[model samples]
Target: MMLDADQRRTFAALADVLIPASGPMPSATAAGVPDALLDQALGYRPDLAELFAEAVARCTGKDPEAALDTLAAQQPEQFQALTLLTAGAYFLSPRTKAALAYDPPPRSALDDVDSYIDMLSTVVDRGFAIR
Candidate 1:
């Protein structure tokens, strides 16, 4: 689901407040939190789409910081949705990832079953103690 222009502006404004530039880090907007990255983030978390949309709509035309404060205080669920999506999207940017020195873990699974065999055997020895 694409955000409308106003929603995009509002989201950008709010995201900047939530994740302003830090020492070595860029702000949310600089990291593309409200642009293509946002779409990618929503794609990763489709379950949060509705809540995120509602959050943007609710904050539209309001002062970004004040709106965030209100949402955090009086509408915690929406606030959580907004912050999660914003941060999620911010991290999706290559620039952001590089700035944070993020390294994605290997996709291949390691077969470590043998490493825990002794623990498994102990559990088996205990047997099933049904209450």
Candidate 2:
């Protein structure tokens, strides 16, 4: 997933908070749980993996879980921004409009989130540092 095992739960909690299901779509937590996606990205998208890793390292130093907690505590705004960034990545995927098994809300069959996530993921995967 996007986070390590321990980080998974924390990330999930954060995801749920940051991008909750509103009316018709799943929360970013469910939508962006990147087990396979993360694996693929880490292996295939070296740039993204490195960029994201840098962020993790900056926060946690080594532990992904600690990184998230630290990021939230030390840099709440950055943490929130990261959460939205991840959500955007998942939203931009082609499956946004596709029916989900456990659909949430706020979003309907608009295929909007899919696109958002896809684009966001691409932008950050390359490890672009935003100042």
Candidate 3:
């Protein structure tokens, strides 16, 4: 999924509003929340692309915060969904993680343990079956 240049700028502006720069955390745009990332995360949902486009159009030439507030009031679900998607994309960026000093745990080598346990349970259940 990709956004045209104009849409990317608009989405970046929206992301800036959704996540402003703070002491440690950079704004969403600075954290590398590009429209392509957003599109990839959100494009699967039906009508979300249209809703985001409409919201961006309506927000143009307006104060981003005010526009977000109005959009949130008028379309809470869309606003929330966009917020979640934007945050998810933003936090996934290495810049954001570095800013926040967040180091995710390494992939657990024991990940297969649960599957192994489940397989054993299935085998035991089958063995104990009356038939």
Candidate 4:
């Protein structure tokens, strides 16, 4: 589930429109949204591959902004897939994450059994019921 060269080019164009450079942030293409980063994103969410491909195909040879507007208006699902994949791929870039200061440290899960004791008791008392 990978984009062909033309599809990748179209996707890059559309992605740049959606996520252009701003302040310290790079545009989507600058962040590799259409290359390895995009491949990583598609690997992570394979469900989006088909719809994302359709979006790229639909927008081919059209004005990126106008195509996005039309897709958003007339084919919302495809637009959503395109936007999600574009943003997801852009954010997947190490450079993009660094620019946004979005490094999230791993945190250990907290044990909060005491806080849910009352709710757990109520549910336990109700027991399981089959319709």
TM-score of every model?
Answer: 0.84, 0.42, 0.67, 0.84
**What lDDT tens digits, residue by residue, belong to model 1 across residues 1-131?**
98888889999999999999998899999988888999998899999999888888889999999999988898888899899999888878888878978778888687778869988898899998887
Name the candidate, 2 or 3, with the larger lDDT value.
3
RMSD for each of the candidates: 2.8, 13.4, 4.7, 2.6
Report the error of model 4 at residue 67, Å: 1.2
Q: Which lDDT value does model 4 have at 8? A: 85
- Residue-level lDDT of model 3, residues 28-93, one tens digit each, is 888878745575566555456666666667767777788889989998766776677788788678
lDDT of 2: 0.56
Candidate 4 structure quality by residue, lDDT tens digits, 96-124: 98898865898869978897998889888
Name the regions of candidate 4 deviating beyond 4 angstroms: 103-110, 128-131
Clashes of 2: 27
- In terms of lDDT, the poorest run of 10 residues in model 1 is 102-111
Steric clash pairs (candidate 4): none
Best by lDDT: 1
